[model samples]
Target: MSEAHEARISRNEEDIQDIWKVVEDIKKVLAARPPLWCTFLLMALSSGLTGFIVRAFS
Candidate 1:
Protein backbone atom coordinates (compact mmCIF):
# COMPACT_ATOMS: atom_id res chain seq x y z
CA MET A 1 0.00 0.00 0.00
CA SER A 2 0.93 3.69 -0.25
CA GLU A 3 2.58 5.68 2.54
CA ALA A 4 -0.57 7.72 3.22
CA HIS A 5 -2.74 4.62 3.47
CA GLU A 6 -0.29 3.02 5.94
CA ALA A 7 -0.18 6.16 8.06
CA ARG A 8 -3.96 6.29 8.18
CA ILE A 9 -4.14 2.67 9.29
CA SER A 10 -1.56 3.28 12.00
CA ARG A 11 -3.46 6.30 13.25
CA ASN A 12 -6.72 4.39 13.36
CA GLU A 13 -5.11 1.62 15.33
CA GLU A 14 -3.73 4.10 17.84
CA ASP A 15 -7.14 5.68 18.27
CA ILE A 16 -8.79 2.32 18.88
CA GLN A 17 -6.14 1.36 21.46
CA ASP A 18 -6.58 4.65 23.25
CA ILE A 19 -10.35 4.15 23.40
CA TRP A 20 -9.96 0.66 24.82
CA LYS A 21 -7.59 1.90 27.50
CA VAL A 22 -10.07 4.59 28.52
CA VAL A 23 -12.92 2.08 28.67
CA GLU A 24 -10.87 -0.26 30.86
CA ASP A 25 -10.02 2.53 33.23
CA ILE A 26 -13.68 3.48 33.48
CA LYS A 27 -14.60 -0.10 34.30
CA LYS A 28 -12.04 -0.21 37.06
CA VAL A 29 -13.29 3.05 38.48
CA LEU A 30 -16.92 2.00 38.42
CA ALA A 31 -16.02 -1.33 39.98
CA ALA A 32 -15.02 0.65 43.03
CA ARG A 33 -17.75 1.86 45.45
CA PRO A 34 -18.78 5.06 43.67
CA PRO A 35 -21.88 4.15 41.65
CA LEU A 36 -23.37 2.18 44.50
CA TRP A 37 -23.10 5.05 46.96
CA CYS A 38 -24.46 7.55 44.48
CA THR A 39 -27.36 5.30 43.56
CA PHE A 40 -28.27 4.65 47.18
CA LEU A 41 -28.16 8.35 48.02
CA LEU A 42 -30.43 9.18 45.07
CA MET A 43 -32.92 6.49 46.01
CA ALA A 44 -33.02 7.52 49.65
CA LEU A 45 -33.69 11.13 48.73
CA SER A 46 -36.43 10.19 46.28
CA SER A 47 -38.17 7.93 48.76
CA GLY A 48 -38.02 10.57 51.47
CA LEU A 49 -39.67 13.10 49.19
CA THR A 50 -42.28 10.61 48.12
CA GLY A 51 -43.21 9.93 51.72
CA PHE A 52 -43.53 13.65 52.43
CA ILE A 53 -45.75 14.13 49.40
CA VAL A 54 -47.96 11.26 50.39
CA ARG A 55 -48.41 12.68 53.87
CA ALA A 56 -49.16 16.13 52.50
CA PHE A 57 -51.78 14.79 50.10
CA SER A 58 -53.43 12.69 52.78
Candidate 2:
Protein backbone atom coordinates (compact mmCIF):
# COMPACT_ATOMS: atom_id res chain seq x y z
CA MET A 1 0.00 0.00 0.00
CA SER A 2 1.02 3.64 -0.53
CA GLU A 3 2.66 5.50 2.36
CA ALA A 4 -0.03 8.13 2.48
CA HIS A 5 -2.79 5.51 2.60
CA GLU A 6 -1.01 3.67 5.40
CA ALA A 7 -0.60 6.89 7.35
CA ARG A 8 -4.28 7.71 6.97
CA ILE A 9 -5.23 4.22 8.15
CA SER A 10 -3.00 4.58 11.21
CA ARG A 11 -4.57 7.95 12.08
CA ASN A 12 -8.03 6.50 11.68
CA GLU A 13 -7.17 3.67 14.05
CA GLU A 14 -5.89 6.15 16.62
CA ASP A 15 -9.07 8.21 16.31
CA ILE A 16 -11.21 5.10 16.81
CA GLN A 17 -9.21 4.13 19.92
CA ASP A 18 -9.62 7.62 21.32
CA ILE A 19 -13.37 7.47 20.77
CA TRP A 20 -13.60 4.11 22.54
CA LYS A 21 -11.63 5.47 25.48
CA VAL A 22 -14.03 8.40 25.80
CA VAL A 23 -17.01 6.07 25.63
CA GLU A 24 -15.52 3.80 28.33
CA ASP A 25 -14.87 6.79 30.56
CA ILE A 26 -18.44 7.93 30.11
CA LYS A 27 -19.70 4.42 30.95
CA LYS A 28 -17.67 4.45 34.15
CA VAL A 29 -19.03 7.83 35.16
CA LEU A 30 -22.60 6.75 34.53
CA ALA A 31 -22.06 3.50 36.44
CA ALA A 32 -20.90 5.44 39.49
CA ARG A 33 -24.16 7.39 39.66
CA PRO A 34 -27.24 6.21 41.52
CA PRO A 35 -29.96 4.27 39.73
CA LEU A 36 -32.82 6.08 37.94
CA TRP A 37 -35.66 4.29 39.68
CA CYS A 38 -35.92 6.96 42.33
CA THR A 39 -36.47 9.63 39.74
CA PHE A 40 -39.13 7.57 38.04
CA LEU A 41 -40.83 6.85 41.33
CA LEU A 42 -40.96 10.54 42.18
CA MET A 43 -42.38 11.37 38.78
CA ALA A 44 -45.07 8.73 39.11
CA LEU A 45 -46.03 9.95 42.57
CA SER A 46 -46.22 13.56 41.43
CA SER A 47 -48.42 12.65 38.48
CA GLY A 48 -50.73 10.61 40.66
CA LEU A 49 -51.05 13.42 43.17
CA THR A 50 -51.78 15.95 40.45
CA GLY A 51 -54.42 13.69 38.97
CA PHE A 52 -56.05 13.19 42.34
CA ILE A 53 -56.14 16.91 42.99
CA VAL A 54 -57.63 17.65 39.59
CA ARG A 55 -60.28 15.02 40.02
CA ALA A 56 -61.21 16.19 43.51
CA PHE A 57 -61.52 19.80 42.38
CA SER A 58 -63.57 18.96 39.28
- lDDT for each residue of candidate 2 in 1-58, tens digit (9 for 90 to 100): 9999999999999999999999999788667763675576689999999999999999
| TM-scores, one per candidate | 0.59, 0.59
lDDT (C-alpha, whole model) for all candidates: 0.93, 0.89
lDDT, model 2, position 41:
67
Give me the runs in candidate 2 sitting further than 4 Å from their true place. 34-58
For residues 1-54, write the lDDT of model 1, one tens digit per residue. Answer: 999999999999999999999999977877787878679879999999999999
- Candidate 2: residue pairs that collide: none
Error of 1 at 10 (Å): 0.4
Number of colliding residue pairs in model 1: 0
